[model samples]
Target: MNTPPSPPGAERTDGSSVRIGVLAPLTRPGWAEAGRHLLAGLELAVGEVNGAGGIGGRPLQLLVRDTAADPRKAAAAVDELAGLGVAALAGEYHSVVARAAATRADALGLPFLCSSAVLDALTEQPTRWVARLSPPQSRGWQLYADFLLGAGHRRIAVAAQPSVYWASGARILRDHLAPRGGTVIDLDMGALTPTAVCDELVDRRATALLLLVGHPEPAVSIVQSVRRDQRLTESLIGAPAGQPEFAEWATSLGDDGAAIPFLRYLPERLSPLGARVGAALRERLPEAPSFVAFEGYDTITVLADVLRSHGPDRALTADSWPHVAVEGTRGRIQFSRTPGISVWQWAEAPVQVVDRDPAAPDRFRILHAG
Candidate 1:
């Protein structure tokens, strides 16, 4: 299960099928369960590509490895896939898991492409073999910051989980807000009790709140606590990929409180993509509660574009590898090289402000695109 050589790109075994390793958290629980969505997207991409006559005359042979959303496990899965002689890798939703895949790919000389790891530090290296379809969290924060400042709201309170992506966003917000003479208080929730954290934000009288947590239930708890305990009535802005439970949670607020989730792709008016994904997941995957299916779908679509441009070349040559270009669910993607010798990649893509809880049936606005 760890290492199985897939069909080579140039061979006739299975008539030219290239093995692409898909590392995801198929066994994890909770809102992080969005790994299934990541898988679905990747599988969908493969199906579409194969249906169109495959990549480089070779149909994709996907070898899925469950990272279980664990860093060490993810690393192990990467090694196993490398042993299997997979041509490339695509699918890493978490920051720690993405870094693990990037590191192992560098050592093994394999191409590692992440579907959705927004940490800025992942691409600080000379490893061009590693790429990410998801834009960094800093870029996402920039979009949010610009939107907030443009709307004439100078004072902002930042609340984020103590994860690498959130930490990076917090730092970026500080740098952006300070230059404009705006005050930003770090409402870091990773260290404090949920109740205490809500109380502080409520007592502070903030003009706006930024929710940067990853999982949906934790975010739901935060929203519930903020409303129940803090008695704070303020607008919440966050990256669309932050949590999928926003619309349902926001709608439950009964029109008084709004949860404006910034997203990679907004659902159609009166028909959000999340709702559709949620329904499909409910039937197909009753065991898995929460999964980021769009993340999977988006990542695969982007990686396929890279493969389309650059055929199934095993050797990851720096100069020859074409930059990943794809119209993903998150809009346009242009990954850039990082300065340091790290495994991370960076890109600044356009983001849309999706009205998770539409006041009207046809009221989904793309407030600011990226």
Candidate 2:
């Protein structure tokens, strides 16, 4: 929606190119860094697909729209893309933006293969039109909860911003942690400054502080305050939304960013295919690729396979989720109906609780895996 609307009846494929619409947060308030890496992987895959004879010799094309983390922008982009007659849709990083795009794509009967958004309630009801490649937020956050308990963190505080995604993550942490003698508290980032957050941690005697807030502004500020506060020296800090996964976090905070654990969708060891993709992504990106970039590559890989199998028919592409058995950059990709998740889900995407090493800020240390 941040971009201009496509011309009326814009260039639908006619044995020329097989187009797929891509929705990514590429501008302000959209985590543009992640978007850059995601697009790198997606474009890389598209080139590779074209190299290997794309969709009966038609090149795969991407009509990318920038959502900028806005739901309305995403909805508009979905309408515009559907109007352009794309064979399928792919790629979105933010859960809320992807949710909006999914709702519109479903009503219009367009097949969407979501890349990186992990919210559990992607749709209000089960629908075949949408399928996701990321692990659900509940599943990933619960694994984080287990990691906390295993590390002897009982009193945890979450610095949360006002958003459905952050709220869902905090709820998942609470629901999973409370029965096992753990307590969760929320510090409103809207009302509290970074120094105030440090004071609250000291006053509440919290053993761990989880950032459910946005990055570089409040997240970076909060980490600086907490790390500097001598009163809470023993307290652990975490970011379950994976803010620490990017290079910007390290650039802004340096060694202060180390040891702040977060959820990442990657295995302990890369498979042969994964290693090859990682090397290619590092060449394409300014920094080593995060799991998000792998997610982007895998998204296009699965879509290209599906398109090759089903051949550009929209309804048939939507129906093909359950039958997809392609190998992804992380693992084998497939979709199934998960209880309460109203879309086809990749139930086996790997997740790890990892952090930067204090000694080497550029390196990641995997603490736990699930």
Candidate 3:
């Protein structure tokens, strides 16, 4: 809940700091830790950039606000940051918050770069000032469907939390796999006990279980319950992307988390630059870096590139973003106007399916990549 103080508008005495506003859910019920990790990544990138002489010899300063995962709060945060006269805007994890921030940024004509919010509708319009670095939820779901079908999973059982994000992801999964002759069984985790859910899945002869829970505790509970039932040993259990992308989700599940597949931005093999960044991140945070952190890092890195190429002018910053194509930790950070996606989005963001090792839960092995 402690928001960073806003930086002085581009008119500071030194006139050598480029201020960028970061809007995230730092104290929201379900988004606190994720937001913290995101901030860590952003700070790391800022440190790296500053060490390299910054953009056009101007140090990048981040002025952050807590959205608390609320749409109205996100919009207000954008307005406040704009009032501070930031050169550009970035950082948001929740889709709903991102949508609100995106709308406000477009209206204000501020360049806003979204990180890790997967809602398809975020990019379904022609908002010239808004761009996203993450692929849409539909693409992620399609990847999940492809993985399931390739693994010979036909009878699929889905257990989803009642959050709007989870519900939308579950719907996308069902819509994608059902048309391919896969038998989809939907269960609301909020209305059913884990034991009962497992029993039904077992009784229905489900070959795969897709968990769409976004938070850590519930996701761990369901995974533990499913793991306890010996009948599901051969069944493929997937956490999709959002649930298991957090370090807490895997750590909370502990050894039982092994072999449960999930989507991630980092590949099993890291690029040379990625290895250095990963080491830097591990040294700073108590836990290993999650995909969200990588996303935050990439967001700032790309933003810096934009500022460097177009200078620190706010108007030029907004104009140069659509043409940005810089390489980051994950892959090339490029924004193209795609139909039904954000006006300028990195539609081909690389994602991979990975599972924790049974012997070492912290370590993971890649199952698929695209």
Q: Highest lDDT among the candidates is held by which one?
A: 2
**Model 1 off-target regions past 4 Å?**
1-16, 29-33, 55-57, 229-231, 235-241, 245-258, 265-311, 316-319, 323-348, 358-364
User: Alpha-carbon error at 267 in model 2, in Å?
Assistant: 1.0
Would you list the rank order by TM-score, best first? Answer: 2, 3, 1
Compared with the true structure, what per-residue lDDT tens digits does model 2 show for residues 1-370? 4662432332455647889898988888999888887888898899899899988898888888888989999999899888888899999999999999999999999999999999999988888999999999999999999999999999999999999999999999999999999999889999999999999998898999999999778998999999999998899999999999999999999999999999999988999999999999999989999998999999999999999988999999998999999998899999999888999999999999999999999999999999
TM-score of each: 0.76, 0.97, 0.91
Error of 3 at 246 (Å): 3.1
CA lDDT of every candidate: 0.61, 0.92, 0.80
- TM-score top scorer: 2
Q: Tell me the tens digit of each residue's lDDT in model 3 across 1-370.
A: 3465443442353556888889877884638778877887888998899899998887898888888888888888888888877888888988878988988888888988888787887633677788888888888777878888988998988887776677788778778888898878888777888888889898899988888765665767788888889888887788886555567666677777788888777665667777788888888788888888888899899999888888767778777766788888877777787777755789768888778878877777788878
* Candidate 3 Cα deviation (angstroms), residue 39: 1.4
Of candidate 2, the 10-residue stretch with the lowest lDDT total is 4-13
Residue 269: error of model 2 in Å?
A: 0.9
Q: Number of clashes in model 2?
A: 0
TM-score of model 3 vs. true structure: 0.91
Q: What's the lDDT for residue 355 in model 2?
A: 97
Can you write out model 1's per-residue Cα lDDT over 238-350, one digit (the tens) per residue?
54445533334444444423545565533332134445544554555534323345556665565566566666666632323345555554445556664532444434444
Whole-model lDDT, candidate 3? 0.80
